[model samples]
Structures are given as structure tokens and as C-alpha cells.
Target: MNKIFALSAGTLLLCQMGMAQQKMVADKIAAIVGDKIVLRSDIEGEMVNLQRSTVDNTLPPNAPCMIMEQIIAQKVMVMQAERDSLPVSEQDVDGQIENRIRYFEDLYGSREKMKEVTGYSIYQLRERFRQPIKEGLLAKAMQDKITSSVKVTPSEVKKYFDAIPKDSLQFYESELEIGQIVIQPKATKEMDQYSIDRLLEFKKQVQEKTSDFGRLAILYSEDPGAKENKGVYILNRNDKQWDPDFLAASFRLKENEISSPIKSQFGYHLIQCIKRQGDNITVQHILLKPNVTRNDLAEATKKLDSIRLVILNGKMTFGEAVVKYSDLPMAKFDGGMLQNRMNGSSLITIDQLDQPSERDIVLLLDTLKPGGISKPMPYIDDQPGGRNGVRIIYLKTRTHPHRENMTDDYARIQQRTLQLKQAEARDKWLREKIPTYYIHVEDEFKQCSHIAQWIGSIAKQ
Candidate 1:
């Protein structure tokens, strides 16, 4: 099931549980919220990705009947959110939009190509998606309201562990202990001026031809992924993954319009709007980041070299330097530590490291035993706003696979226990609220085995 999820989603926001045989679509005017209509498409689209990978590809009358009941219940909660004037922030939407773009980018390959295939620019796709994404996020929040209060005592966890048969227990494939140091090179005045000068010249050329925005992107844009997208990205209304300045400026453009140079931490961008629909827009952009020079990189490396020497000489410790110098906020509190992002395990496994850091760290660690330090070396972390850096790391500790026990796996166990509690609470909420909503399951599904549980009180047997 996990493998199926990976194949279908690779990081899609949708959550799925292993279910069996469910293939059906309906066009019922299921319910209405003030001015909005809830069609079968809305409910079923939410589950299409789920059913695609579930063990049961067949749509049992029982499962659809139960899910339809849940859908109507979700609508009621969304309606309540509207009535209460609950709001979602633009920051959140931008982040979500970016995440969706990445998913589809992975799905379709290249943002521009996705635009060509989907027949909607990234912006247009995102705008159309914005409301649905918001609706989904809001619905989840509402679901949380019902399930948030559920809690499990220590006894519940022991019971949960006991309930699982010995052979049925889940064993993690592996774990790792990792140490890292990072040094970020500063952008220089000359490189910044050069990039700004190029944009200024490009703006002149754009003004001269006006019809060749796409052509210019092909020739000069440095953003490799989006350039393949023809310098264009779709904006979805509920997308939450974009840089804010990028999102706002794109939406503000008029059709066939070129925007002024927009600068962000990523670099400089020149935007051309291809189309617009309400809050969403499809726009192409050329990005040029000032590249760090050899001297600038050398300076950062030199600094790390000094730190490495000090630690090796016993003047200072690697953890102390990490506390003093690492810029990553998430790593700062952990003493500039490197952990497997998948599970936050201190040791990164061979398969877990995707960047050059994995090989570099392994080689560095091979030369040192526990409590030993590595020389300053270059490493790259694939993160937004991540850049080339040099740092020294210390091998803190290492662990090997063992039977799951309380001392080493407390956090993972606690989370699973909480999830079990939450699932039960959601079921309890459905049992109580199912009768209150105006629900009318298709008569074909009414006699299914699960229908009574979905709609609360059952008729006499």
C-alpha cells in the first residue's frame, strides 16, 4: 500500500488508507451551500486518487454509500465555516499552490509542459484549483474540530501494541545517524549589479519586440525547470507553495501584459501575463540569479577551514560551532545537526540522501570514529533558499536496527496511538451527526451493509 501511494502521489497532499474495489461516478446534485453547488464530481474527485491505489478497485455499494454520507457531512461543515467567517491566509495558499505545482511538475514533468498538456497555464490551473484547495483544507480543519479532542492514555498505547499480532508488526526498513556543517557564501556587489544590468537590457529588448516573451525565455532564463515551462507558471487560487511576491505580481498583470522586474530572495524575475481569470493568471517569467564568484566561495570555504582546524585542535567543538554559525532555523535548535527528513532519524540511510551531501558525509565519516571530526567540505542541501556552503561535521552517535521498543521509538509510537484515537473519534462524530444532515444516498446503495453505520440509526432488522 505504501509503495502504491508512492507511485501515485510522490508527495501529493491527499491522504489514503488501504481500501478495496471502488469504481463509480455519480452526477447527483448532492447538496447546496448558500450559493455553491456540491456535485458528485467534487466528492468523487476527492476519492479518485484514493481508489486508484486502494486494494479494492471495485466500488462496493457499501463503500460508496458510506463515503457519500461523509461527503454530505463535510459540506455542512464548510457551510458552517462560511457562516462563521473563518478565513485562510494568502501565505498558506501560496505554500499549497507551490506544493501542488511540484506534484504536477513531478507528474507531468516541467511546469511549461504541464501547461501545454493540461491546456491551462500554471496560473490558470492554480486559480481554478484555488477554491477547491481551500474547500478541502477547510473541510479538513472542520474534521479536526470533531477529532481534535480525542486522546489516548498510556494504557491505550500498551493495548494497541498488544492487539497487534507478533507477525503483523511493522518494522522500519532502516535508520541513520548524521552530522553536517554548512557555510553560505554571500552574494557580491558586482554579481548583483551584473544581473540587474542584464534584466534592464532584457526589458529593453522585450519593449522593442513585445511579441517575443516566450522566445526570450528560451534564450536567456536561468530557471531551468520553469524555462522548460516556457518561462510560464500557472497560478492556482489555493496554491500555497509559491513565493508571495511572485504570486501577487502575477495576479496583478493584465492580459498579454509584461510586468516590471520583480525581485525576491530567489533572484530577479520579468513576468509576461498570457491570460487571466478572476484571481488566477498564467504568466511566463525570466529569472537571473547573481552567481557567487570563485573568490566569494573561497572566502566561505576559508572560514569553515578555520572552524575545522579549531575543532580538530580542541579549541572548540563541532556542536558549539553549529550552534554559533548554522543559519537553518530548523537545524539551529538541534545544533546545526543533519537528520533524515523522512523520519528525523539522526543517521541518514544510504537511500535517504539525494544530494551530494550524502556521499561527501559518508567519505568524511569513514575517516573518523565516533566523537571524531571531519575536515571542512562542500555540501548542498536541496531546499528552497538553499545555496552552496562549506562546513565541518562531527559523528555524534550511531544506532542499528532492533525490535521496536519504548526507549528508542517513543515518538513514533505516541503519534500512531494519537492517530488511532483520532480515527475513532471521527467515527463517533459521524455516528452522531449523520442523521442531522440532509442525506439521501442513491437507492441502489441504501441496502448496502455499511449504509446503516454511515447514516447513524438503522431500521429494525
Candidate 2:
């Protein structure tokens, strides 16, 4: 996800302590929205959180000004929500706040570790964040309500689509709408013994050698997020992605202590607790993917090949075979049709195809066109993940690049129209309601590009 160019809470909400702490006491009110104050720390905190939470970290150089502008917009929204008597209940606010907390906990390691990192526990964190989340949600709801009246017609969609210059199109190198039935390679007793022995040997390296765990993680860790990061990053206590058993295990460790191999849905891991705050902990970990040999791939492909043979020999239609025998739950239900993850069309542009699978699909589909099918071919999505598995693909369809029309692309246009209409509505609401809220610029950002329309002519950057 892109670093949301939105202005929001930056530095700290409420956390107990972290694995590490930034020494700078970076708290300064950059703007005020009704009773809510936007702080420089808030923006910085969010940037840190966003960097850790999501992928994209790019920011406009005048990010503080951008954030301050959002504060003004939010203040206007809060006032309007109150005046309109929008009934945002306490339970509603608490629910959203708790979800975020849980996500943070899971992300960082545990609630206690998160607290140690942030200097706040889960309960205190919730209390500190409740009003802000409520206000943020309320403002979002008001904006939603404001945009609810906006609508675009089919003609508008076509006009918008056609108005785009040919060169302006965001082109993918290639894309595919692929279907698969996956079967995970079974991890049996002997494999487990082999993996555990290997990890145990690596564990002995840290214990016997004059070295620490981070150095070991850098050399041998398979975790992409940690391997290059020197095994350090902040995670909130409430994150939901990590396994609960693993999280519970992480919370019990002291600094520099190594964990016994802990198994999760993904694979087995060996972790070294880096630091502990209250409910949070920072840890470096090494992950080992379960060994899968060519024999394993061949075993899966052989089964799929048999199924393909049965279909070709007229024992069953391809669709019937997909529904009955294919291991891919998602594709089996769809009769082996796949949706484009981006545009949601059945269309597969040339650039949308994934690598390894891309070359395979292109070669397999050389003679075929749209509404065609492919012979069973090996496709792997078998990353060490919760939903990891291997499959043989069936290419259902491929569409050439052409002008997007209603017959081929309704959902894409509708979603785009909806977003544009919403943006227009939000801009309209802010332009009208901002004067009611108290706002000030830091003098440096007074001359921003978009502020004068939202605020007034008094401040110039």
C-alpha cells in the first residue's frame, strides 16, 4: 500500500514501551481542529507506524503542511458531525479501536511488548486512542454521507474512459487471469526431524561462537522483513497476522534469549527476543521453509495430469473436473475462471501475469485466444505462508488491450466514478465547512498549493 498521503496522527497514540525508543520529544501542535490538536509528533509517529505497517514510504517533502491541511479538514468534519447530531456510538468507536490494537499487538509481537515499546499498555492505549478513532471514524462517516448523494451514469463512465489519452494508460507488461487447484506437500515425521536438527545446529552457532542473534539472523534468516532489517522493527501489540501461539511465545522472553523452534501455519521459526516493553517485544527471527523436492512437485503434477487426461478422454468436461477434482477451492467453485485482482475483470492483460508462471502461460497460450483454455501446467504460489500451496494452472481467458467498454468493464468504471465523485464531494464539504473550525498554519506551510481554497487568503506559504 502507498503511504497514505493523508494527514493523520503521526507520533504516538498511547503505548507502554517499545523494543526501542526515539529519544526526541517531538511534540508540537502544528494545527488545531475544533478541540483536537494536530501535533508534529502525531504525523511522525504515523509515518513510522505506516512505514512499519505497510510497504510504500514515499512522502511529499512538505508532508507536515499536507497533514496540517488534513487537520483543518477533520476539524470541519468533527464540527459538522456534532451539528448534524451524527450518532456515532461509544461501542462503535471501541470496536474500531480494539481492532487496531489487536492488529498492533500481533504486528509487534504481543501486547506487553507493544506496551514496552510505546510506554502504554493495551488498556491505556485504548483509552488514549478512543476519542481519536471515534473522531476519525465520525469524520469518515460524515464524508461518506456527504458523498452518498453523488452518482455517475454509464455515459459519464465512457466519457471518462475515452477522455484518457492513449499514452496516459497505466500499462502492465503482461497479466493473466489464472485458475488453479492447489495441494500442499505434506510435512511428515522425517522432514520435521531433519528441519529441527538443522535449526538446532544453527542455534548452537550463537551459543558457541562469539556472536549475537541479529548477526545470525542477517546471515541465515529467511524472513524477508527481518533478514535485511538487522532483525529490528516496531510492531503494535494487536496485529492479527502472526499466529497466536507464536505471539504468546514471544511475550515470555527476555532480551537476547533464543526461543526453541516454534511452529506456526507458515513454518517453524527460531526467535531471539530483542527487547521488552510492557505488552510488546521486539525480536529477530530465522524462518525455515519446509523442504519440498522435485518429487513433491512431480507428485502434485502427476495427480493433476491424470485429472487432465480423464477430461481429455471424455470421462468428464473440464468444468465438471474442476468442480469435482481440482484442489483449488476458489477456482473449483468458479468453474476454473479467474478474476483480475486489479480491475476485477475476467480480462488478463499481457503484463498482469506473474513471473515463472508468466512465461509458462505465454508459451502455453501461444495458439489460443480469449475464451480459450490451457493444458495443465505447473504453477506455484508456495511461499511459506498461511495459505501456501502448489497447483497446476488452467488459463481460462485472455483479453487484448482495447478501449474499455461497458460490455467488458462495468465494475472498474463504476468504482472509479464512485471514488472521483467521493473526492469531489469531500472537497466540496471541506470548502464549505472549514471556516467554522479554528485553524492556524506554522507560517512555513501558509503558502501551500491547495490550502487557500480550503481555508482563506490570510496565510501564504
Candidate 3:
């Protein structure tokens, strides 16, 4: 699991104290693994975070013990990663930062709101999270490296399942296999031209000093993820998250230069390059998506409905229809099947279908039986760079609640078995590796049962 290091209340309080010129107690070292020191503040910070995150806002009795052990494990992995010279690229770090920032933006509704609540700008937050995220990624990479070769055979999987007591077997909810044939509503050429013209006007205003680019972005940018930050972004030339057209336009500008309206998949943008540092550039932009009119939606719906009729009449298979007509790049490539993000399987539970954005689709799915297809339905694609569209849902299969079994849930069982095998391998590796490194825990935490192995190993050292 990847660990996210969030700023806890304790850290915020310390920051506030510092800003007020108040003297605060210094943080103490709680433990040391090799040359890595885990500070008392780190433990307290995590404890506070865990307490706040729990249902009743309380930490478990053994929370400190658990947290400390996890920290020790992570530190040990980090030491090994460093020793082995594990590589973490700058692009990977930037990607993580972007994802973290996007998550907070969703949570707080906007970057400005997040900054107001957290008392830190997005850039500052990224800088603070940079080291921790990098270290966490390194630790995870090391763990994966250690467990990469561990695999469970068919016999081992059956043995693992047989070993589980009958009463303790896991129960699964009713799951559905769903697929879709999507058609994106496209704006008319006139509407697209209007959007470009509007952005061009905005560019003129910015160049003439009649309006501020950032101010205009805050007011007019449709890129919700960046609007609250005045549409600011620090982008690398090779970052895949950016649209090629937008990226190219951004890189073409000189410092303090504004570009003409550029059209990308997301929409039209007027970009102002703020600064350039080698391959990295900071730019401010205002985005405006072309108006996808009701006519556009109706046209898309009609097209999807026609495709659905052809599939139902056996003139074309659903997968063939997906390949021929679907505009969704990712789903089209996979025959329009919707896979569970957790397990990377097409099987999804009804409860998983209860997400607010998927409620309409769930209702449509309720009317569908196995191998059934629904009429084209309207849905706003909530994905990044998504737009309003119509799609026909395909219900491929649905399974009922059942105990763990080979026939109904072989893939899940196999995954669980493999995980157990990998965990055993990880423990064996740790046992062999820990003694080679310098390890110490605080005297107070020596009572933790899991720490005994480390303590014993230290004694041997």
C-alpha cells in the first residue's frame, strides 16, 4: 500500500505558532533505523491524523504500537531502497503531486478553498509533501521488488482456501458485469468557432492590459480543477496528463507572453507563459468548453440508439459495435467493459453502483437482465476532460451472494491466495534483512509484541 503523508493538526498548530513568533518545544527522535530517524512529532502527527479520520474521532488502543511498527517497516524499506539505488523519476514525483492536489481540490471544492482551510498554497503544499511522497514511493517500490517473484500455484491456492475454516469463509455481494457503448456529444462547428473567438477576445484584453489574465481565469476558466488557483500550473514538456495541443502552445510562448486561442480535447484555452526553467514551464490559462447544445445531445442519442438496435437484431455484436462506433478511448479498446478499479475485473457489486454519479446507470441496470441491453441514456461523463454524452448499457452477467467457492469466485480466491504467499515471502525477507541494518526503537514502545523480533535482531547485532 502507498502511504500518503498528510499534514496533521499538530503540524498546523506548530506552523501557526511559528508564524506568531511563539517559542515551541523541539521535536525529539523516537527511533532510528540505520541513519533514518523517526521523530516524536512524526508519531504524534500520525496519531492525530488517525484519530480524526476514525468514525468516532478516536484512535484504537494499540494505535501507537501499530503506527510505530508501520513507520519502522517503511523506514527499513527506505534504507534498503537507498542502498539498492532504487530509482524514482521526477515525472513520477510530479504525477503523484498532481494527483494529491487534485484529490484535495475535490475534497475542498476548489484550490482556493483548500488553501483557505489548510493555510498553505498549492505550490507550498506540494513542496511540503514532495519528500514524504518520494520516500513512500521508494519504500513501496522496494516492497514490490522483494515480492515480485512470489507467486501461488493452482495447488497452493486450493490448499490456502482449504486451510480456511468453514465458518470464517468470506461472503461476496451480488456482482454484475457491465459494459457500455458510449457516444460523446460534439459541439457544432459554429459553436466551436464562437468559443475560439471568445478566447481570442480574452487574449486581446490581457495583452492590452484592459483585463488581468489570472483575474479573467478565476472568473471564466471552465477547468474546475485549476480555476480556484487562477488557472496556474507548472507543467513539464513530457507530462502526459496535458493535452498535446495545449502543451505545444504553452511551450511555444516566451516568458510573459500570451498565446492565441488554442483548441485541445478539453476545450479552447488562452495561455500565458509565466516562466520557463529548462523543460519545465509555469503557465496561467483560461479554458472555455464549446457549448454542447441540446441538438448535439439528441443527435448523439439517436446514433447510440441506432447502434443498440443493430446489436439487438444480431446484425452486429456489441463488441463489434463498440469497436466501430464508441468514442470512449479506454473503454472502446477493452470492448466497452467496465472493470472494477480495485481488482481490475469486469465484476462490480450493486453497492459499488450506488456512487452518486452512477445512480442513473444503476437504475437502468436494474431493468436489465443478463445479456440485455438498454436504450440510449443521457449521462455527463464525470471523468477528467469528460463531456455530456449518451450510452447504451450492456448487462453481461450478474451473480448472487455466496460463500467463497472455486466455481463462482475463482479469480478472487486466487488473488487472495497470491497475496498471502507474497506476504509470507515479505516476512521471510524482512527476517533475513533486518539484522543487517542498524535498528532501534524507543524504550517505551519495546512492549509491542511485533517489535520483539527487531529487538532480538538488535541484540544479536
Which of the numbered candidates is closest to the native, going by highest TM-score?
3
Candidate 3 structure quality by residue, lDDT tens digits, 65-184: 777877777778778988899998877877776776776687678667777777776657766766777777787788889889988799988888889999998898888998898888
The best candidate by lDDT is 3
Q: Using TM-score as the measure, name the better of candidate 2 and candidate 3.
A: 3
Candidate RMSDs in order: 6.5, 9.6, 6.0
**On lDDT, who's better, 1 or 3?**
3
Clashes per model (N, Cα, C within 3 A): 38, 66, 0
Candidate 2 TM-score versus the reference: 0.53
Candidates in order, TM-scores: namely 0.69, 0.53, 0.74
lDDT of candidates 1 onward, in order: 0.64, 0.63, 0.79
Model 1 residue 330 CA deviation (Å) reads 6.5
Candidate 1: lDDT of 309? Answer: 81
Off by over 4 Å in 3: 1-25, 52-60, 162-167, 185-191, 201-258, 271-286, 292-347, 354-357, 383-386, 403-406
> Model 2, range 57-130, lDDT digits (tens) per residue?
66657665555566567667767888898888876776677667766776687656787777775666776776
